[model samples]
Target: MAGELNGKIAAVTGGASGIGLASVESMLSAGAQVVIVDRDAIALKAICDRYGDAAIPLVIDLLDPVDCATLIPKILELCGQLDILHCNAGSYVGGDLIENDTSAIDRMMNLNVNVVMKNVHDVLPHMIERGSGDIIVTSSLAAHFPTPWEPVYASSKWAINCFVQTVRRQVFKHGIRVGSISPGPVITALLSDWPPEKLQEARDSGSLLETSEVAEVVMFMLTRPRGMTIRDVVMMPTNFDL
Candidate 1:
């Protein structure tokens, strides 16, 4: 296992499944103290059993500001340091711009942008105080690719991309590196929610990017030398028409 991250403390939101799960494994293997935060209690319990005590699993609703506040002290208690915050939780509600439902739009904006902003707000002060930290956020290829059919998801990602980029400029001098990773179609159970008929078509048409592919880039960003920062990483499968 790679140990480049040894002795580092890495906090990962949405760490229970998908790319988050891959990151948890990679971070632990790289010898970082890993904290997996998610709202899935059963999955959280399973992760604790699977990764042992060093892989601390916390049940959290990212939409809650108090949850983020609670997270900081826990990290201090468990690892005595906070060197990385990997914000990788995201959700999608499909609809064309003209046909989108109001509630769906709200859910996408609230869960994606609002929660991320809150977590960043809560962590930035601590990172700035330490004068050394890395913030890795999950942006999306859709942010750049025009997808009016998925307007809310694409727009939310676009907002996050700008937010992280701005933070990179503001905080890099303060010893914090802020960056984003935008991956192609990541193969997760989340995609399986589509109808079985559409699922095969989606894969055949171009939607087979694996979660590990994106997780690898995330590791690349967080594990680089202290003085360097990977400003932005945007990638999609060649076959992906998007």
Candidate 2:
């Protein structure tokens, strides 16, 4: 499995930590030159330093429209050609929708939804020209289920789920494979939004997934034969309930 990604170049958003960081390590181990894209300048620098040139760091606020528009362009500028793109950066807003402010809701939608679309749109041209590329968006299990607690967050992911499938239909003929990974309750900072008791219960019950576990799924999706597109992978802990 090692060196499976040799000669490939990848760009992962939110690559400084959590699922993104773990995926970065997985891709690097498989022999891909990964560009760690995140807004955290310090963390990005640290990660790049650890991996040397194999890990290129790009620090920019994705929430900013100007920065978001320029993400793929910048990655292409740095890597020449982007063989893979992992849209893993996202924000969480759990609990009743009424309890959150409009600003929080807006921010979540912009990053979790808008920015993802923009990045995909921007990268499509390059991929189409080359006639080959892989795109993986990080969706959530909430997108498939109607969970009332986090309506807003779930809605954002649902939008992404739709987007991924629809885009796949349109782009497959171009030799571009598009898909999403819908993971349930991974142990990341995103869990901070869950109720304390619920989080503790999941941890105690072995129902929470690790970031690396999710990253391994990303690796699997990437390494599949080009003719076979894994449309969506929904992974969860064996003990996970609802």
Candidate 3:
């Protein structure tokens, strides 16, 4: 198990921070070289420095379909082959939709929904030709339940959930595994944007999870025996109310 991923190369979007950063660290420790893709050039460089030769940092905007299309080819250029694609980049907007501007909604949908579709579309052909690969996405508990506070965010996650399920079947014939991890209220910068009262409530109730917890699930999905493919995993703090 020490070199479970000895020959694999992985690309993690949003890999500069939070759950994405945690997954990057775990994959590297599991004996895989990883490409850290994010818009934060500074953080990407810092992570690449920390991991040295194990990490290749690519600074790119996930919201741009054009940029998303370029990711796998760029990754292949850097690492030679890509065996895993972790689409962990996403954005959130809270409060009632009435108060959310149309442009804000568009940005949210573009990042949370469009980017995932584009990444998968662009990566599928290469994966299919190779006859094997894995695609893991970061979904959310919000996808399973309607949350009034972050309606748009929840809807976006729902879209990803559907995408994972449908695409998993499509790629199974090609030996590709597609799945998602849905975590509730993780203590990441993503949660830093929550309304002040909601953040306080989650903190007071000890219902916030750490980034590493979700990262563990990512590794779990990757390391499963080839005969067994975990389709979805939902992770939440023990005390999480919803």
Show pairs that collide, candidate 1.
none
Q: Write the per-residue lDDT of candidate 1 for residues 9-88, one digit (tens) a residue.
A: 89898899998899888899888888888999899889889888779877878666677568767777777788899888
Candidate 1: segments with Cα more than 4 A from true spot: none
Error of 3 at 201 (Å): 3.7
Q: Which candidate is the best by TM-score?
A: 2
Ranking by lDDT: 2, 3, 1
TM-score for candidate 1? 0.92
The 0-to-1 C-alpha lDDT of every candidate, in the order given, reads: 0.83, 0.94, 0.90
Candidate 3 positional error at 187, Å? 0.7
RMSD of each: 1.9, 1.0, 1.3
